[model samples]
Structure formats: C-alpha cells, structure tokens
Target: MQSSRFVIGVIGGAAAVVAVGALGTHLLSGTQSTTGLDAHSTVTVDGHKALSGDIVAGRAQSRYHPLPWVGDKVSDVICPTGLKAVAGATVTCTGHRSDGSTVSIPVSVVKASADSVTWKFERS
Candidate 1:
C-alpha cells in the first residue's frame, strides 16, 4: 500500500511540473499578435496615407488586366480593365460617375507604408 501511494505521488508531482512549465512557456511567448488587415498587409515605405497634391507616376503593361475598384466600403464597386495593380506597378482604373459618365483614370501603386499602399490618380 505504501509503495502504491508513493508511485501515485510521484506521478502527480510530475504532472504538476509539466503543467507549470507549459503555462510558463505560454506566458513568456505572449498572446498579443497582429490581426485583421494589419496581419496581411505589408509596408515597404514610410507614411500611412498620401499627402495632398501627390502626383501619380508609374508604368503599366500593354496586356489588359482586370482590376476591381472597391468603394469606400468593401462592396464591389466596379471592375475596370487595366494592368494588375501590384506593389510599385502602374495600373489603369475605369470607373463610372453618378452622372452616368465613364472615366478612365491612371493609377499607380507607389509603395505601402504602415500596412497601407499609397496610390496616385490621374485623368486619362
């Protein structure tokens, strides 16, 4: 009977040690992590938003590509035909105004800063 009690006590102590170690490791590792858009977006330059009166500059390929123009909200606004808008790539975005007029605009993805990409717009 005494031997059985000793074995059980030893097992319990080992389990307690393991649990403590796991908790300690988890606490040391930390639980705070980046989430949402900040998790997927990357910034390669400085600044979050563009300054006023920034000129749009860049070049696009000849082959036409589909680029979606999202509204202020995440809803689908328009799908414009142009080059794919990538980091440091120039693309064209054609959108329709509320006045029933179509407008083709040149867009440039200059750089991303602080989880946001800077864009320049020009009339075409």
Candidate 2:
C-alpha cells in the first residue's frame, strides 16, 4: 500500500510540472498575427530597409538583401514608412506565427492585383 501511494505521488508531481511548462510557453510567446495579409499593401524587407514606390499584384521586385533568419527566428521584413504613408494608412504590419513569432514577410506590394511579393530567401 505504501509503494502504491509513492507511485501516485510521483505521477501527480509530473503532471504539475507539465502544466507549469504549458503556462510558461503561453506567457512567453510574443504577440503577433498569424492571419494572412490584405490584398493590397506595402512590403518591408528587413535586409535592405528600402521602401519602394507602390506596387501592384504584378510588378518588379525592389532592391533588398535578405538575411533569411534573425536571432534564429524567421523575421517579418518591413519597410520604414516615408514615401507617401499617412495617418490611417496601414502601411505597417506586424506578422508572426501562431505563437506570435515572425515567420513570413512581405517583399513587395500589389495594389490591386493578386501578385505575391518575393522574399528572395537565398542571398546572392
């Protein structure tokens, strides 16, 4: 009977540890959106930090040098606002994974089309 009680106590302790671990992960995760981007918007490349003029669904890529990953995590490339951004214009976006980490990036913009901006994952 004593041995059975000891075994049960060990199991209970293990379960408690697991619960604490899960709670810690939830608290440490950064706050970012996993939802896809809008149909029309500007892109910011972390590599070059260049903000090109507005682009449409089908357009040439602007200048940028990509690093692929930052601090071991995929980062969202962003262009600093300046060219013609104004208040109420959501030129800035915060991207991330389901846990709120940067995993995707917007390499270009397609104002009124379905064009996808390229991130040029491979650096030349």
Best by TM-score: 2
Runs with alpha carbons beyond 4 Å of true place in candidate 1:
1-87
Question: Model-by-model lDDT, in order?
Answer: 0.39, 0.34
- lDDT by residue (15-90, candidate 1, tens digit) is 9999997776555433122211233233222333332111121121111111222221111123243222245655
Worst 10 residues of 2 by lDDT: 57-66
Where in model 2 is the C-alpha error above 4 Å? 32-72, 75-79, 82-124
In model 1, the Cα lDDT at residue 76 comes to 16
The candidate that achieves the highest lDDT relative to the unseen native structure: 1
